[model samples]
Target: MHSLNRLARIAAVLYLLIAVIGPFSIIYVPSTLVVAGDAAATTSNLAASTGLFQAGLVGYLIIFLAEIVLTVILFDLFKAVDHTLSMTAMAARLAMTIIHGLNLLSLFVVSLLASGAAYLSVFDPAQLDALVLLLFNAHDLGYTIGIVFLSLHVMVLGYLVYQSGFLPQVLGILLVLAGLGYVIDSAGLLFFDSYLTTPFYVAIPIAIAEVAFPLWLLIKGVKEEALPKAAPQPA
Candidate 1:
C-alpha cells in the first residue's frame, strides 16, 4: 500500500511534466511557425527559426519517452482493479505512443527540407516549400489518428479507476468526459474543414480532467484503507 502511494505520486509528477512540455511543442511552436495555406511563408518561418523547430522536436521526444514510462507505471498502478481492462488501457496507450513516435518522422522531414542541405539543393525552392506544408499536413493527420487511440485508453482507464476503491469515482467520471471530448474533437478534425478555425470548447473537459487527476494524486495519493484486503491462506 505504501508502495502504491509512492507510485501514484511519481505518476502524478510525470504526468504534470508531460502536460507542461506538451503545449510548447504541440501548440506554441505550430502557432508560431505555421501559416495555413501559405507554404512559402511557413517554410521561411521554419528556416528562420530552425533552432525553435529543433527544440520543439526535442520536446516531443521527451514527451514520447516519458509517456512510455508513465504508461507502464499506470498499468501497474491500475491492473489490480480489472486486469483485462487495465491491459486494454495500457495497449491503447502504447499504440498511441507508437503512432506519435512515427509521426515525428514527418516533422523531421520538414526540418531536413528546410535545412538547405547539399543533397536537397537539387530540389527547387518552391518544391521544398510545398513539401514542408505537405509534411506538416501529414503530421497533423497522424496526430489525429494517435488521439483516437489515446481516447480509447482514457475511456478504459476511467472505467478501471471508477471501479477501483482507492481512487475517487468523480475523477473517473471526468476522465470519461475527457475521453469523449477527444473522440469528438478527433472526428471533427477528420471530417470538418472548418474545425481548425473554430473554437475548441470541447477540449475544456480534457484539460480539467487531466489537471484534476494529477493534482489529486499528488496531494491525496490513494486511499490506503480503500484498497481491497488480501485473502487469508488456507491452513
Candidate 2:
C-alpha cells in the first residue's frame, strides 16, 4: 500500500510538473509572442524574445521526459486491474510522447531559422518569418495528432480505473469524457476546415477531468483493500 501511494504521488507530481511547464511553453509563450495570421509580426515577436522561445523548448523537453515516466508509473499502478488494457494504454501514451518529441524538432528548426544567423543570408528576412509561422502551425497540427493517441490512452485508462475499484468511478467517467473530447477535437481539426476558425473552449470542461485525477492521487491516493490480488504464475 505504501508503495502504491508513493508511486501514485510520483505520477501525480510529474503530471503537475507538465501542467505548469506545458502552459508556459506551449500556450503562454506562443500566444504572447506570435501574432496569429501575421507572419511578419510572429517572426518579429520570436526574434525579439529569442530567450523566451528557447525556454519554451526546454519546457517541452521536460514535459516529454516527465510524460514518459508518468505513463510507465500509471501502467504499474493500474496494471493489476487488467494487464492487457494497462499495457495498451501505456503503449498508446508512449506513442503520443514520441510523436510530441519529434514535433519539437519543428520548433527547433523554426527557432534556428529565426535566430538571425549570418548563414541565413541566403534567405530573405520576410521569407524566414513566413517559414517560422508555417512551422509553428505545423507543430500545432502535429500536437493535435498526438492528442489522438493520447485520447486512446485515456479511454483505456478510464476503463481500468473504473474496474480497479480504487479511485472513484466518477473519475473514470470524467476521464472517458475527456478522452471523447480529445477525439472530437482532433477529428474536427483533421476533417473540418471550419474547426480552425472555431474557438477551443470545449476543452475547458474536459480539463477538469485531468485536474481531478492528479488531485485525487495526491490527496486520496488509492483504496489499498480494493486492489486486486496478483495472479499466480505457472511454474
Candidate 3:
C-alpha cells in the first residue's frame, strides 16, 4: 500500500509537470518572445517555433501515460483505505481519471488533425481552407466535451476533498473554484467569447493546488489520525 501511494505521488508529479510546464514552455515562452520583440530576425525563427509545439506534443503524450499509471495507483490507494472518505475519494478520482483519459485522447487526435492541416496548407491553399474549417469544428466539439467532463470531475474532486479529513479544506476550495472556471469557460465558448479571459488565470493556480494536494496525500498516507471513521450507532 505504501509503495502504491508512493507511485501515485510520483505519477501525479509527472502528470502535473508534463501538463503545466510543457504547455507553458511550448506556447507561452515563444509567444512571449515574439510579443516582446525578442524574436529571431529570419524566417527560420517562425519555422523553429514549431519545435516548441513538437516538444509540447511529446510532453502531452508523457502526461497521458502518467495519467494512466496514476489511475491504476489510485485504484490501489482506494483498496488500501477502508473508510467513507476514502470510498468517496476513490469514486471522484475514478471519474476524473476517465474524463481526463478521454480529454487526452481527444487532444491527441486534434493535434494530429491540426498538424495535417498545417502540412497540407503548404501545398494547397484550398485544401487548407477546407481542412481548417473541419479542424475548427472538430476542435470546438472536442473542447466542449472535454470541458464538460473536466468540470464534473473537478466538482467531484472538490466534494471528495471536503468529505475527506485527510485532505486540506483549502484544496477543496480551489477545486471548486477550478470547477467553476471550467463551467464558465464552457458557457463562454458556447455563448460569449469574452468569458474565457479569466479562466486561463484561474486555471494556473488551480493546477498547482491539484498537484500539491494529491502529492501530499499520497506521500504522507493521509496522516492516519485524519482518516475518517464510521460513527457509532445509537444504543
Candidate 4:
C-alpha cells in the first residue's frame, strides 16, 4: 500500500478503537455509576464495583493517548492543504488531548475514594460520597471545555479538507456543522439549566461527520491525480 493509504488506514483503525473504547468508559460506565439523586446508592455502586471503575479509568487513559497519535497523523495528512491552518488544527487538538488527559484524573480520584484508601480515613462516609459526586460533575464539565477546542480543530480540519480538492466538499461542510453542533451543545450545557434537563442530541451530527470522515480516509483516501499542487507565484 502507498504511504498515504497506510497512514489513513492506521489512523482509521485508531479512530475506530477510540470510538468503541471511549463511550463505554467515559459515558456509559460513568452514567451507570453516578445516580442522579441517590448519593448513597452511587457510592455503594462504585465501592462494590471497584474493578469496573478502575477499568474505566484505564480505558480513558488509553483513549487520551491514542488521540495524541491520531492528531499527529491527521496533521501530516492535511498539511498539504494549508500549512498554517493545518498546524492550528493540530495545535487545537493537542490542547484538547492534554486537557482530557488531566480530566481523567478526576476518575482516578474516584477510584481512590471508592477503594477505601487508608489516607481517606480523615473524611467521613458522607463527605467521601459527596466528594466523589462532585468530582464526577467536574469531570463532565471539564469535558465541555475540551470540546471547545476540539470544536475549533474540527472546523479548521473541515475547511482544510474542503480546500484540498481530494475529498468531497460535502464531507467538509458536514464536518464544519458537526463542530458547530458541539459548540452549541457545550455552550448550552454549560450556561443554561434547560440544556441539562434535556437530551444532548445536538451532538448527534458529530457521529455522522466523524464516522464518515474516517471511513473515507481509510477506504478512499486521496485521489492521487486530484491532489492539489502548489501554484507558482508571479515573477
lDDT for model 1:
0.88
Candidate 4: where is the Cα deviation over 4 Å? 197-201, 229-235
Q: Candidate 4 lDDT, tens digit per residue, 1-235?
A: 2376677788888898898998888788888889876777889889777778878887888898899999999877777677778889999999999888898888788877887779999999989989988888899989889989999999999998888887899889989988898788778878997777424466567888989988898888776667555443234
TM-score of each: 0.94, 0.93, 0.61, 0.92
Q: Which window of ten consecutive residues has the lowest lDDT sum in model 2?
A: 196-205
Per-residue lDDT over 1-235 for candidate 2, one digit per residue giving the tens place of the 0 to 100 score: 4488889899989989999899999889888887878999998888789889899999999999999999999988988888888889999999999999999999999978976789999999788888999999899889989999999999898888888888999989889988888888889998887886324565864788889999999988998878897544334
lDDT of 3 at 150: 60
| Residue 42, candidate 1: C-alpha displacement in angstroms | 0.5
- Kindly report which residue stretches of model 3 are placed more than 4 angstroms away from their true locations once superposed: 3-8, 25-50, 75-123, 133-137, 199-208, 211-221, 228-235
Model 2 scores what on Cα lDDT? 0.88
lDDT of 3: 0.54
- List the candidates ranked by TM-score, beginning with the highest: 1, 2, 4, 3
Quote the positional error of residue 30 for candidate 1 in Å: 1.0
Error (Å) of candidate 2 at residue 171 is 0.6
- Alpha carbon deviation, residue 73, candidate 3 (Å): 3.1
